[model samples]
Target: MEAKSERAERAAQNELLFRAVNEQILQMTERFRAQLSDIDIVCECAVASCVGTIRITAEEFVRIRRETGTFFVLAGHEDTDVEDVVGRRNGYVVVRKQAVAADA
Candidate 1:
């Protein structure tokens, strides 16, 4: 069986992929480049079946990325066993992995 730490690491890695994709999306949008426009990004949840969206501005996204192990997920999608709810905002919440964030 996969260890809890391992599972948490894997989940964080999955969230990282979603973060990368969102970053790419923000970069591609001309409007967001000039102003802080809100965009719908895929939720960075650990669950494979989750298809939730997070509405946040590009500036807010950049602020979230400034911290290591931090990820943005849809409201109520946080995994308390592996992550902690660090911040709450409209439509979503920010989570910080409990540990093993660097593995990703």
Candidate 2:
């Protein structure tokens, strides 16, 4: 019973962290929308932790790359074709950074 309670507490904490980060990303997207009129931005949040994926126009991608110092990894490089519509080339997924202390 104690173990179950502990697990539930951890889940709740993770959920709150996820929500906080998701809101931050939404705010950032809104800012992007206001500055650049050419491209569109879409954000996708993960149910677990601070992980998320964002889709932005290719032009937006370039702008974000220039603005932020964050690093990104290439995904969807398998049998799936990465090149498709706006979400494919122009947009990117935004993942939240997790603190080392939180991992414990």
Candidate 3:
């Protein structure tokens, strides 16, 4: 079995990667002066090979980014083994990693 700390680390890493991708996308779209409506965001799941994308409003993305422990994931992509589902939207879900993962 994987150690709790290891799982947490993995989950944190996955979230970090997802956030990096989202930040890049944001920068690319910033110049367009796009309205704060629907935007495409990478899935913030604990799977290294995942390439899924979820659509979320820019305002929603900003809200999720404000919380360090919370991540926006595609529907059904949440890893319940490492995180808890905190909110569900029409096309995405918000997950908060366990405290150990959050600390990492």
Task: Please tell me which predicted candidate would have the highest TM-score against the true structure.
Answer: 3
* Runs with alpha carbons beyond 4 Å of true place in candidate 2: 34-104
Error of 1 at 17 (Å): 1.3
> Tens digits of per-residue lDDT for model 3 on 1-104?
99987987997898889889998887777766465467798898888888989987777788778877888888888888788898999878999887845686
RMSD of candidate 1 to the true fold?
Answer: 2.9
lDDT of 3 at 1: 95
Q: What TM-score do all the candidates reach, one by one? A: 0.84, 0.33, 0.86
Q: Please rank every candidate by TM-score, starting with the best.
A: 3, 1, 2
Candidate RMSDs in Å, in order, are 2.9, 13.3, 2.5
Q: Quote model 3's TM-score.
A: 0.86
lDDT of 2 by residue, 1-104 (tens): 44754554454455345445544654566667666544332232222423444444445455544422122212431111111112233334333223311342
lDDT of each: 0.83, 0.37, 0.83
lDDT of 2: 0.37
